[model samples]
Target: MRRKSKCVLGIEGTAWNLSAAIVDQSRVIASAESSYHPVEGGLHPRAAAQHHATHMEQVIHDVLAKGKKNNAKISAVAFSIGPGFGPCLRTVATAARALSLSMNVPLIGVNHCIAHIEIGRWLCNVADPVILYVSGANSQVLSYRNGKYRIFGETLDIGIGNALDKFGRYAGLQHPGGPKIEEIARKAKCYMPLPYVVKGMDFSFSGLTTAAKDALAHAPLEDVCHSFQETAFAMLVEVTERALAHTGKKDILLAGGVGANSRLMEMLNTMCQDRSAKFFAPDKAYMKDNGAMIAYTGLLMLESGAVLSVEDSAVRPNYRPDEVEVTWR
Candidate 1:
């Protein structure tokens, strides 16, 4: 199949934000993200979907306007279609399908988690690497094998980011508490011993978060924060190393929201260097969740011949990463 010569408009509404982008070949021409302030506790799916319904159009318009300035004609509209809030995903998907219909272009459906891994390829140029994806709703180590992306391991319960964010909230932090915990962890010199849970290639953060909360009764919050980062990162590093060893993959790429943690990145970088392996993380923009990654992956899928019809364009809140069958052109 000949590669299509075209640009893609990617829409992402997996959770917490509404993002849209126009990607031309190797670069993102323009993109816009509208972040929502989650309620006092955390993201309420219905509330997030409501927010998307209210704000996505403006974000789409803004991104489109910016893309138009660069003479970017959207040949397709790609959307993060599953493993997300149902309402939020529906909002974005509806917009994407409508736009594709109006423009008479292909409508591509992308796996949100796979988009993160592809972003690893885009930013790091690391081919066939072990991917550690830690985000609000997902935690998994992925690799491409046997013609599809496979999950070597994943969280047994809650995602690492959500565990950390919940801990932060328990400590009276604001919405999206991972960074706040990182900040507090940076100020502590003591290290509290926290549970490190890793079973084979999989991990569990809920137990550790619970233990950390209990420890706070006698341990300084800062010390607990520091310890949480240390232990949690170690769990990730250990599983990642195991995955690499199991697969004989020397390159490791980090993606998703938690991939932005400086401490985790530093530890992984050092470990990879010591092992003579490569480690890669995208800049802040790509490191955190965004639509550009989805759009870029759409282009790759387009070139590889990955397309979906309107009928099956429904959202799966608990979509598994490896379930997606890659049909590259």
Candidate 2:
């Protein structure tokens, strides 16, 4: 029999998605998400924040309703507290504060990046992995050491997702161009060369995106897509493999939104196979920013006595994973 565990209600609105979830140690009790689809280019910070504010009530209600049906009691309220759009983070932080107060439970502030890593670790059943965390705004190679997740490498300019979206927009594709790029690249017959920038432990994609924009003038769209993905994924994989070698860690965990790309996953898995190591990835739902990750990580923090007081609960727009002490671990 499972011992009864504390439940946490987590609110995530770091960017376009607004989500709420209740979870304990074993499983997600209930979770709900609402996403904003931009009409034109990339996400507008103010507009996304407004969308989160508009839908926050319904999203929270849905998860809270499900939690009630499951007889789940929320012991704390958790919120994503950084490395995100300022307006969106503030909006969600405000909501988390309200929820914590109304429910008379403790409030927990979660690092968005660490939440991704923790949830991936939980779902995939791996510990002490070299994490390849790729998302819209953040791309980092990290591993837990001593007291924190030490960053081994990161992008010098834009994240992989942003790079893909920029190239896709230039080619007249819609927002969130990663999936479309992957789909069209499957039909590509030949590969074209794009800039491959890697500086020691850091990689740069801004130049690659620029080169792809130029390639669109002569090369077929599918070819550009293929080349872009190949070059970029190779850069990421190269750095990730090096991190594993440096850390002597046998496990690799792919987290964040860009980790959902099948090609990226395949490339990382291939590298892991070559190294005779293991690779772990959570479901696509957990790959992106969501509430379950926050709640679950918060549960861990709560047990570790890492609670947040209402007076000191303020949003951090640029929280880094390495700045957090991994008390739960």
Candidate 3:
């Protein structure tokens, strides 16, 4: 008799995006996502959750259809369990539980932050690199030690992405302000001064955000954006370099949605080149909040004998990356 193919189905609804993917041990078979854009402000937890609830079923079906795999071949279901908006996390978790129970497959709860790092590591083929995680909701320098990915440095206030978005809002940019800010910043010929705050190994962006808002009242928008990127990326690079120096890690990986910024990548590449360390980042597909990363990481966890009962698959909106045990490593 021929052996049956086994795959894991992963769901990711951490924030604005509702995504799903099917992954076999070797590669991702299919991935699908739907993003919710706010009309005038940042993502509202309840509203985002409602959007996920409305579209999640269709998204899952689309992913499964794209893979062309039988549901019986799925051996596990994975969901990003947290460090996300409460309502969004709960909505995803509930869907995951229903699927797991219906299929009689194992349920796995993945850490959203860790999934970002794992996908970057897997795609880039980097082992044990210091991670610079910068997303809309998170900013941290992380490294694996003993059994967990510990935070070497982190944001004391707003994350880099959030700071950029808030600044964009103040300038009347649309939702998801990072990309808009980046676009305008590229046209700037001069960089205006902005607050650069890095205390010890940690960094803060609230002050910089405030300063940028104030500067916008007097300074040109392009100059302000340019200055903001320079100052913000500098803080991130500084802390990441410090972490690399302290950990002596020969590799540095950039993960998360904000990793898509060219300026940030350039800064990191320069720092890594100066230090003679390898720099790696996944393709844009895996950089943002996506289901493939969650699926792949979940597959690793399941293969390592980690299991979650349906009843225990509750969401943890405040889940920290370091709290998860690095069993695959």
Candidate 4:
């Protein structure tokens, strides 16, 4: 029988969601989350932070109770410390520090982007895979080399998720527009032309989204949405393909919230199949920002002797994944 490692308590509140989880090496013992939804438009930093502050207690309480019920003893207190909204990051950091002090355990400040990659690696059981991370504010093609997850390609403007949301709002769709666009695109009668800007490895989506929004004046909504998705996804796949060829890696991992898109998954899968490479993605639960990812990553970091003190546990809103040294890997 496989042995399970000690558990870690993790908290996440980077953007729209506030989540808490307890996880060990083998699986997530318990987890809970509360989401923040904007009333009229895209996510607001201050508003989202306030929502996290309001719901954090209940979320944390639920997860800890569940962890207690499972008899899981937390060895460390971990939280998403950077690459997120400043307000939200600070709120989570403060709570993490308190927990660390109360439990008399090590405090692990986890990089949010790295947490996504680690959870993807853990859930899908892939190693040394080229990664395509897509979310509301971040988009990058990365692969592990030396001691860092090197960024091979990235967006020059807004992320694909934000681009889709911008166009969605313009089309009178809801806040998180990717899923809605995907649903409507399936009913498209024909494709409409939109801007496709790929500058070597890096791609631009602001122009593409703008062009798609304008096409709504002349084309059906479904056609515009379908064309928009095709153009954007093609750009992403092109960059990912280039990364794969450059790295000479046979495995490709899709991570981040936007990886939840079925059409995007299909495009990447087709690319991997044509190239005779393997494609891996975690379950939908881990695709977005969640506490289990932070907790699992924290366990890895703690085991590797990467712990933080209260004074060093400040939040980092602009932390980059490549900035971290991959000690555990």
Show the lowest summed lDDT stretch of 10 residues, model 3. Answer: 64-73
Candidates in order have lDDT scores of 0.87, 0.94, 0.92, 0.94
Quote each prediction's TM-score: 0.96, 0.99, 0.97, 0.98
- Per-residue CA lDDT of model 4 for 1-329, tens digit only, reads 66767899999899999999999988899999999999998999999999999998899899999999999998999999989999999999989998899999999999999999999999999988999999999999999999999999999999999999999999999999999999999999998768889898999999898888888888999999999999999999999999999989999999999999999999999999999999999999999999999999999999999999999988989899999998998
Candidates by TM-score, descending order: 2, 4, 3, 1
Among residues 3 or more apart in sequence or in different chains, the pairs in candidate 2 whose N, CA or C atoms overlap within 3 Å are none
Off by over 4 Å in 1: 1-4
Model 3 whole-model lDDT (C-alpha atoms): 0.92
Error of 2 at 42 (Å): 0.9
Please state every model's RMSD to the true fold in angstroms: 2.1, 0.8, 1.7, 1.0
Model 3 misplaced stretches (Cα beyond 4 Å) = 1-5, 69-72
Error of 1 at 175 (Å): 1.5
Estimate candidate 4's alpha-carbon lDDT, on a 0 to 1 scale.
0.94
Best by TM-score: 2
